[model samples]
Target: MPGVDHCLQEAMAIPGAVGASIVDYTTGFPVATTGAAPNSDHEAAAAGTADVIQAANSRSLFVSAMPHDLLEDLIITTAGGYHLLRMVQTEFDSRLVLYVWLDRVQGNLAVARRRMQKLADELVAT
Candidate 1:
């Protein structure tokens, strides 16, 4: 399996990929990150994402609906880029996530998502 850095590099190799990071959802901490803009603040981004996920989950429960067996993945598209967030279901209570940013002009959302799914399978927590 590839290391975390190598995994992020491979993600960037995908057409239109701009940045990628492996994050820990429980604490909203980044295990590794790559290709963000010069002034991007990854820590803040991760924390915010975690909060978003938690809110979504809570909303589902409040609606009297069970959450998806698992979150599997999430995608957000903006005027400038596409953000892909995938939760990695490891063997413990702790969960991990892959956060990716793709340039909309060049990115193929389907392909990027497929590549991220494959990479997540190969990533192992140490």
Candidate 2:
């Protein structure tokens, strides 16, 4: 299985990829990170992203009826880049997510999504 660093490296290689982080959704903490912008707070972003996911799930009526299945993925677009979040489902209750930032001018969203999915599958947590 690919390690977390390897996974982040592969993500950075993607067209338009600027930064990436592997996060623990349960604790809203980053397990690994790469290519953060100068002066950017990656930890805060990871925590905020987790909060957004939790808030969305909690506030959605449809989600309330279903079992507490982890969120699979999320995508957000900004003026400069795209943010892609992919959740890794594990046997344990803890869920992991990959947070990727890609430049809008250079990134291929479709390819990034596919690669993130593959990477998520290959990751083996120790």
Candidate 3:
């Protein structure tokens, strides 16, 4: 398994990748990051994205339908680019998220998502 640093490096290597970070949602802290910094302030972006994840996870309409399903990931596509958030289950923490910002014109959403999922699966905290 790749450690957090290695995982972040691999994430940044993805085509059209603008930024990437591993966030601990419970505390709104980023465990690792690379490429462009979100919002010129990674801390703020980490906090904000944590809120996004929490909001998505709490929706009764979605969660009620699959009570046993843990959130896998969340994607937000904009006119200019895409924000992909992949959840990583950890033995040491209750919540972790891999967030990557990609350029829409150059990125393949399907490929990025698949690679992100694979990275999440191989990620291990160091």
Highest TM-score among the candidates is held by which one? 3
**Which of the numbered candidates is closest to the native, going by highest lDDT?**
3
Q: List ranges where model 3 is wrong by over 4 Å.
A: none
lDDT of each candidate versus the true structure = 0.80, 0.82, 0.87
Error of 2 at 90 (Å): 1.3
Of the candidates numbered 1 and 3, which has the greater TM-score value?
Answer: 3
lDDT of 3: 0.87
lDDT of 3 at 5: 87
Residue 107 lDDT, candidate 3, scale 0-100: 89
What TM-score do all the candidates reach, one by one?
Answer: 0.85, 0.85, 0.91
* RMSD of candidate 1 to true structure, Å: 2.8
Supply the global lDDT for candidate 2: 0.82
Once superposed on the true structure, which residue ranges of model 1 sit more than 4 Å away at CA? 37-39, 61-68
**CA RMSD per model (angstroms):** 2.8, 2.5, 2.0
Local error of candidate 3 at residue 37 (angstroms)? 2.6
